[model samples]
Target: MLKKLLIACLLLSLIIAGGLVWSYQQVKSSLDLPVQTPENVLITVKSGTSFRGLLNHLAEEKIIRPSTWTRWIPRLEPELVRLKTGTYQITPVMTLRDVLALIASGREHQFAITLIEGDRFIDWQTQLTQAPYLKHASKTMSEAEIAKAIGASGIEKLEGYLLPETYHYTAGTSDIELMRRAYQAMMSLLDEAWQTRDQNIPLKSPYEALIMASIIEKETAVDDERGVVSSVFMNRLNKGMRLQTDPTVIYGLGESYDGNIRKRDLRTPTPYNTYTIFGLPPTPIAMPSKASVLAAVKPAESSYYYFVADGKGGHKFSKTLTEHNRAVRDYLRTLSK
Candidate 1:
């Protein structure tokens, strides 16, 4: 009887060992086997999705087999259960373990939108509306309404408020949210620049600095010339002279501007007409980059009071009207050639 009992115990232990080996093999095979598909597939995991629901969805799409093993593996591994909510691209050659690891790692698909320096507010609106990935909350809203939605209430205009940069976002990001981020970024930078501004600068407030920066942004594309251009404006402002900047006149002409700034356009009366006005424009004409903003508050120490395009993507600085007229003549001669 004792010998028969011992044999029974040995047979039971052998059966348990065999079952363990079979389970291990099955798990390994499931992880190593790739899904049967001809092309890559995009899987959108919505927020608040349960782990079981995600597994069921994968099984329904035939990316993985709907077996007890697949269902139990995630339940057994605590690290593989949680998933992030976003759009994920899955390839046909990826194994079940690869797909699970990819989703669990939370590396979701990213889309980008760029806000260009010197772009008008209307241009920003058009680009935001055309972006397919962003949720269009402000599509039909007016600029004022959009400003209010982004916590910038009572703003008469939206120009020059947004910081120019490339923003990355996922599928559910809203236009309003992007606008808010841009506004905050500009405000933060503007505040820092304003606090560190030069002593007794012409700019009285951060908004005035922003206005000057916008003009500087539109005036020159040369990165190193921004400080010199800013110095010209600062000198003019200190002497209580008219800005006489052509871009401000062009902005004032609005739709009536035919890509040319005639003498009559400069003489015309408008709030943005710095040619006739004695100070900065009431609002910014375009988005100003951080560099331009910094140049506005910290202009170079120079006596320059005027600048004109040198026909080489740069400008020639002058301290007197006679010198400026010569630079203007040189510019016209090149243009006529």
Candidate 2:
């Protein structure tokens, strides 16, 4: 009777070991998949959720069998807890064993935030707010909020800090995090550009250089004209002449612009109006690109003091008002007809 009982115990132990091996292979191999084949699926692991809850979610998603997990979890890992919060991509035929391994590894994803060169403030705000993964921005995301995100304080506008580039972010990234990355990148770029700035520049600080860069950005879409425009502005600055840039007037007029810069708009007084102000605006009027920043710090060698639209979205430059007005007459008159 004792021998028979010992043999029964040995047989039971062998069966359990065999089951473990089978279960391990079932999880590790794609051949055990009951469905078509391996498939891809996006999974989000929520914070503070229980391991059982996650298992239940996976079961509901049909990635694993409910009965199989319910039977195996207690036996395999009773002390298991939910994973850290993140976005994960899972595969079909992935069993509980493989899923647990993934959770432990915490492999997340990265996505992009595209900042176009010509995007307006509201346009950037819309892109940030519309991103579903990022936390909802507060109803009032003030310039201060934007400033602080990029390691600045008390800045009146978000321009210059909001770099024009494609940024990579994870699904777990917050709106502030996205803003922070952009600002840091812009700050770094500014430092690099400012280090090589011309000594005779009229700008007092790096901030002022950034201000000039934004003007350069708004003045021309053509890359080659950026340096020329910078030279024109610098010349005007040297002579105590008004910038008379139409974009500055548009920015100064705020939301009142009707798609046109009328004569009265130029004559109007506003803090942002370079036409009315003797120097750079109180703050940057728009976010500038790296190229624009570089161009501002290192203007082209020229005596150009005036520029006008050349009817092809570029500028006709001049060293004197007479020449500028003539170019304007030629270009504007040609376009109007």
- The TM-scores of all predictions, comma-separated, are 0.83, 0.79
List model 1 lDDT by residue over 228-247, tens digit each.
Answer: 99999999899999998888
Worst 10 residues of 1 by lDDT: 69-78
| lDDT digits (tens) for residues 73-172 of candidate 2 | 5445544343768877676666555666667677676667788875666678888888756675543767677666557787766766778888777685
lDDT of 1 at 94: 90
Question: Model 1 off-target regions past 4 Å?
Answer: 1-20, 32-42, 47-72, 75-78, 89-95, 105-107
Candidate 2 stretches greater than 4 Å from native: 1-24, 27-41, 48-52, 62-82, 91-101, 120-122, 145-150, 333-337
Model 1 CA RMSD to the hidden true structure, in angstroms:
3.5
lDDT value for candidate 2?
0.77
Best by TM-score: 1
Under the 3 Å rule for N, CA and C atoms, how many clashes does model 2 have? 0
